[model samples]
Target: MANDTGREAVKTVPETAGEDQQVQERIRKQIASELNLPQAKVKTTVTLLDEGNTIPFIARYRKEMTGELDENELRSIEERLQYLRSLEDRKKEVLRLIDEQGKLTADLKASIEKAGKLQEVEDLYRPYRQKRKTRASVAKERGLEPLAGWILSQPRRGSVLEEAAKYVNAAKEVPTAEDAVQGAMDILAESIADDPKVRAWVRRHTQDHGIVVTAAKNKEQESVYEMYYEYSEPVKRLPPHRTLAINRGEREDVLKVNLDVPADKIHEFIARQYIRGDSAAKETLQAVIADAYKRLIAPAVEREVRGLLTEQAEEHAIRIFAENLRNLLLQPPVKGKVALGVDPAYRTGCKLAVVDETGKLLEIAVTYPTPPNNKVAEAKAKFRQLIDKYRVELIVIGNGTASRETEQFVADLLKELGRPELQYIIVSEAGASVYSASKLAQGEFPDLDVAERSAISIARRMQDPLAELVKIDPKSIGVGQYQHDVTQKRLEESLGAVVESAVNHVGVDLNTASPSLLGYVAGVNGTIAKNIVAYREENGKFTDRKQLLKVPRLGAKAYEQCVGFLRISGGKNPLDGTPIHPESYGVVDSLFQELRLEREQLGTAQLKARLQEQQPEELAPQLGVGVPTLRDILDSLQRPGRDPREELPPPIFRTDVLKLEDLAPGMELHGTVRNVIDFGAFVDIGIKNDGLVHISQLSDRYVKHPMDVVSVGDTVTVWVLGVDEKKGRVSLTMKKP
Candidate 1:
């Protein structure tokens, strides 16, 4: 394996070409090109991280070395490397299995060596591979394979039954030739099943054209699985929701599900592969394979194809969920105002809390604004007194238990007071209960009840989503689809990336950011996060981002990635409060120099206008940076001291609450979609049970997936299709009635 210079040689290592080794090699070459190394020098043995390359580091610092490989491409390279290595290990294991069976023929060995993909290699290894006791073994035990073949030959118009009967002697323990041929047919069935080419072909055909057919095992069986009692659809075309539902139905034993490929098509395909044209033996061979299809191969292949489809759907769901969660979490915060929080309930009344501009609790109370349970007039009075007493400018309502009724009650009070300036939001209270029971919640609110603590947290969430939301686990936020099913580590990694991206996108205010939010910033982990909080306690508020450099272990690289996303409001320099990374300060300065403008002289509104007028070609050359980067810097300089997440969108405020019975099919109604997985979108539609819009029912055009059209927080227009009050399930569709 040594090369001309004594290094490892670049070996082609012939593989069974399933997807294409060239695609993989192209990716490797791309990686090598990015690293500024020859393809030969970058061996497969090298680890990306051990070679001093981080994802961000390789993406940002080694741009010239990576041929400007972006984050997405780098991640793809990392994934493909793992898959290729796994394929190699699998190949070795397969070869070992065949060799140990002592059936490794020269032809078989040649086929395996020449194979360019895993599928092909596995195919060639199939016949010789060890397996459990089968019908083929029993036929061999009876010593009747040749007899079966002779009957198949039908010599001189002989009767097959008579010929088979002669072979079935008392010594063999077969009662008759019919029985002997049955055993022979079993052997042929096993042979057909073991054929690698047939297996590979069947797999491809099933994936490409198979349909999932479901039927009620017993039509009279009464259970919660009525909708899917008898349902069937093409595998590729089945929506994510129905797939999950059908799977659940099968698990619960109410339905029988099978992968349905046209039997005729498979028979024809197999006939082409195994049977010769117009021969006497052809009929016998066809009969054996037909028996195999019914008794052996069909079930096995069906299971394999079904499993593959499920895996593909699950992966698609995980990807969509991650993206939707990112957007929802990164939404702009409505900051710098006192907020009144309300945790709405009917039996206990609405629990309320008032927090100061910085989200420190100032008061708590229980109030009822409208009801047959409590006097509407009295409840309204109590609520008004609290709002006036606390001077609350905004209200935060938890979108939970009686939220719409409470919003209406509060809206009525606001209208009576003539305060149009006051606004309220219905925030998702996903992990509020979990947080309420946690040690952190207890430590923060030792004197307040759990409900009151929840109310206070809701208020703070509006003030700073990044800080407040980080206290709860990302998975608990309810924005993900099949969040529980994905590989736990991958889920956590993807969700963590989303949180970090969101936090960084809307830069944290260093002076006010909590340890949880700080920990997510680039280069700041839990220990450093705690240290920053401690340092701030000892040294007062941070006036500028430069003060971060003095914090222990806060290095230049970390500072560079994080500073732009960490803002300082009311600072001397306006740029400190914007997403203009400190490393690009020189570029901003040069832009100002060309315009004869001083740093302090720039105002956000005018500066943005001016930058737009000054072409990228005119400004980028002067700054000595790429036009893309220069344009971004100019845009940031214009809005020097701005909070990226300005105001949270107004939460759904309804005048009245309606039950599921109140909704009619074809009624156009507004509702929030709580979760979106691979198959379909789940819309709350203000009902007790959320209704599913199967992926097929999602749009007018062909939708490859539900995620392409909708996301978790999206407020959608849905037409109520049907309602099952007993099951507490509503059926809604995005399509117009």
Candidate 2:
């Protein structure tokens, strides 16, 4: 091998930590087993992460350190590491608290220590925890704990009344034998409820045998939850989307959701655990078991199971949202000569803005092309003036209110001009309003109103979706189903990672990136990003990556983490424009020398030919670099400052508009995927509303999810399935006509 290639990722880890070495080792081994990664790699990745290495940086620049773990794998490791560490911390806290109360036992400590989930640890700690004025605590105060224990022992030879009589004391508020026995039974029942083993068994039984039942709160009050007016489904088979739907309905008070589990099975299991053969206390224990199930155990387990279900649903929803957002943000940027953006509205006239080649706002104008005003001629005249003046090659219309009307008007106007080279594409304006209303937008275009600013955003989205979309909150992007319904914190976290990954994947142009885009780059916070922009503004464009070290609050660590992702075109060192890290410049220099090539030959046909002749595997050893790094270096050198997103299919530009009425069964039409959900993908086929291609109609073969067949921003050839003009819905099919 010519370099330390991809195949030679280091498989050994050196110990270095101030935390518990044993616990750290345990976490490393556990994560390794769980993710099926080599333990050495997991340990090394964890150490790098602990040293504050960002996932993107570690993934891209430290392939040898991580044994070639990608961003996804590294993220998984970080998540699991945090969870396991939290679990460890809680285990110590629980043990300390139990020992302070003088109730800790060897077996109990072992159980809690061995618990895998936070829930399990909490369960094991439940019995020793202090209670708030419960019947059991009251019984213990009345000196009936001994009686409860006696009953639990199931002494067949002893008389129940005699034992109860001994516990009776008027001074302690137990005046009768029956009252004494009842208080004792309360103690016994509470003990049964608090037992972790008993709780685990009951939880498992409920999950296996339970049914989720939902019923209407008021049948006469119509809602989208009408289908759930009287519905029941087995708990084990409930899908994530339905779980979220049911939870939302319940929260809105439109439906009452409950779990129905087999009580007889639970009671029998408890009876077998607590009762001895032919015990005199059998009947009394049976009553206690039933009471425990109904009043204490059942409700708690139901809530726990519901919470688990919601958590799973939330994770699933966040995963889907992340994928959809990733695709939407990674859409291939369309480089038009000069582009026009139109924010369409009915009562308000359509707001339009035109941008120059580099996304500079050239002009802003408005025309009432749709409804109420119906000023088509005026709109056309204004657009013609802007188009001819700017030499606009592409028109981007926002798919919002009155969008179809605007599109139709533009189609007719383009035909009247007979400019065959000009075309139009509809861009999703989901978060344009949010962005325009934000302080960031105000800062960017303080002179314009919200509508005009939104129009400009629409145009820039087609030019560079990632840069523009980063300004808005990911929740407002409207790419996922039930985004608003899922856990906001988790969704935001996942979407943030997606944006970060996309931004880092494409690499940011150091001189031109806005603070919003730069902020998403690994190791760059909002302040640091703002400082970078301000530095560029004050010092002029960055001439090399080394200038980043001079930015305020940007230390050596941050520079190391983020500099590789920051590309400087026409920099002093040509390698600065590539994704190749500064640390590996020596290796790259060695490679260039060995190939008899010069930096001037980068991205030339000569360089490509030379790089094609040598194998990274054969050259990695001699170059003293990892094969993965070498391959990436070769690719980056071949196309320095390249945007990976540009390699993907460009937006399908439309020269004509199609109405819902124009679509018929089996009419083959090309479209772009607007959004993806559990049920299907919504495709924009140049219409008022996006058409749905349900999962069943997505392919000739089985598709577990619509994403498996198509993604947001995917250009697909679809056929019309049917139309419901009354509902203004167009059903589409991805299957061949």
Candidate 3:
């Protein structure tokens, strides 16, 4: 029976062994089709996933078994596999519930089995789904169900009134034939509404042709949702951004939203399906159809349509967030430089931190260069002292409050110092405060205040974005659109996957990585990560990857999954720094012998050239490994200890900051993409406010999404389209036109 939750609490029937195999086969086929991968490959990947291998580990180490599916594809397979398994369980439960009712039919069972989505299964079982007291239930209780069935059959010989008259009984509360007919019609109305095929057809028609209309609650009030106040768009054509905007507006009580469905078309379609003849009861049946649609079907269809739209929008938002986070995390680290980090403020004074080439804090200070207390000379003197003392090569300024004034101050200070070689970059200080106040930050810097810790974070982020950014929450990074609006659980999972993928792709330095960074490694949880760090601190730098097995709570399984992604430079084994796993050491040794090279010469240019000359297919036979593995080994040999992010463009550095007023239409400038959303991208062009490049201006041709053209940390050339000085907003266009 249906509970308050509106779902039937069915007793689960365990699937037979054969049924389980069928379910697995069905899932494999679905995943293969969805991912455009071979069925065999999907089967292998699923087996690896079921065996507890992480996506990164499977993608990197088990390429031969899984046909070389990348991390993204493997993630997709995993998500779909989980959904399919849940779908199968629900299908079994639904089938069992229907069978127990003694009402399950061959056609109905077939329909349930063929159902692709949970909604379809629910619709097929809607007739038997227990519900609260309704008009239909009241008619059934009044003994009018027989008359309702007669009316539905629409026999040519009998008069509908005569059949309905026989159902009238005083004891049953049917006082007259008219009352009996009305009661019967109520039951028939609900039956028509409950028909699975009828509901599916109506849902599909409405979703294809319906229009979503939104109007402001108060026309006079201005809001961020003003554009959606009088909007009407086809449901099929509505973009994810507009749907999310409309949903947000409705949630905020600023807009009234409704669906404009084709009621007349829906009525005609139902008539053709349920109406059997031009009998005397045709008018009565037509009235019942209208009632059923308006009272039962239309409202439910509208809700389903809205839910589908919301699910799509949420998925899109999550995908965008994940992509932006990946790009932001993979931003090229500025290595081998001493930087002075500034956390700008007005009343509190700007907090300063100086770090050497390795991001170790050398000094901390405070200066008032902006607002009520503009101690320009004092700030300049302090900056000169720090730069000279630490031999600082770059200034890393947090793009937060009072950043413009701070930039002006730094530019002036640089001129006085005559440091032409020194440049400054405006790094996104998003979540810097959150990280500063975190317990991890306090543990790292017990003597530093929040602002001082934030200053150090900014400096370190510029030096190594991935290492520092992982310490904070991905949601707080500010690279997403509608992040707070999406399902928090799903958003966190997706973003976490992105972080894991990025960390594994760029193997972590075992000696230097913090627990937060290590926690993202494959097979390493927070506890294990902390234990690894503790062990490292107690034992000094790890001399080999094998030592991870000795760390408490880190056993053979954890070491197997994580060792390949953890790099130990100048370790006992030269191959440890590369992605080559410990199990593959024999293959590497054989390859070195074949090439007449020593293990110490592995990363040399000479060895790389020699490895490049050998074909992977030919070498695989000799190495007794798959061609994919051999190719990967060759790649690692060619570029040992290489950072994948170094291939991307570096962040833009500025000697001077530009004011919003400085921008002119058609003026071209190079900018770094700060954040990308569905509608547009925000580009940092050395200005106080980042400029917006709408999706239309993203390219000379049509753009489907901003991410398709650019990603966070990408450098692109854009021309100023317009500037709003009053609002401190700048419009930019990547296209020449």
Worst ten-residue run, lDDT, model 3?
A: 1-10
* Superposed model 2: Cα runs more than 4 Å off: 1-17
Which numbered prediction scores highest in TM-score against the true structure? 2
Candidate 2 to truth, TM: 0.97
What RMSD does model 1 have?
A: 7.8
Candidate 2, 1-737: lDDT as tens digits: 00111101221122245668888888889999999999999988988877777888899999988889988999999889988988888999999999999988998898988898998998898898888999989999999999998889998887777889998899999999999989989999999999998999999998998999999999999899999999999999998999999999999989999999989989999998998887778788999999999999999999999999999988988998899999999998887568999999999899999998778999999999888999988989999999999999999999888888889999999889999999998989999999999999999999999999999999999999999999999889998877888878788778888888999999999998899998888778887888899999999999989899899988888888888999988989999999999999999889989988899888799898889788999999998888999988988888887888988998888878788788889999988998898999899888888899999999999999888888898999999989999999999998897
Residue-level error in angstroms, candidate 2, position 224: 0.6
- TM-score list, all predictions: 0.75, 0.97, 0.95
Tell me the spans in candidate 3 whose CA falls farther than 4 Å from its real position.
Answer: 1-19, 157-165, 169-171
Predicted candidate 3 versus true structure: per-residue lDDT over 1-737, tens digit per residue = 00111001111122234566877898789889988899999988877766667788889999999988888888888888878778888988999999999999998889988888999999988999888999989999999988887777776677877877788799989999999999988998899999998999999998899999999999999999888888899999998878888999999999999999978999999999989878667888899999999999999999999999999999999999999999999999999999999999999999999998888989999999999899999988899989888889999999999998999999877777787889998988999999999999999999999999999999999999999999999999999999988889899888888888899999899999998998888888877788888999999999988899899877777788889999999989889899999999999889989989888887788888888899988789988999998899889989999999999988888887687777899999999999999889999999988999999999988887888889999999999999998888999999985
How well does model 2 score by local distance difference test? 0.89
lDDT for residue 120 in candidate 2, whole number 0-100: 91
RMSD of 3: 4.6
User: What is candidate 1's lDDT per residue for 614-635, written digit by digit as tens?
Assistant: 8887767767876666766666
lDDT of 3 at 58: 83
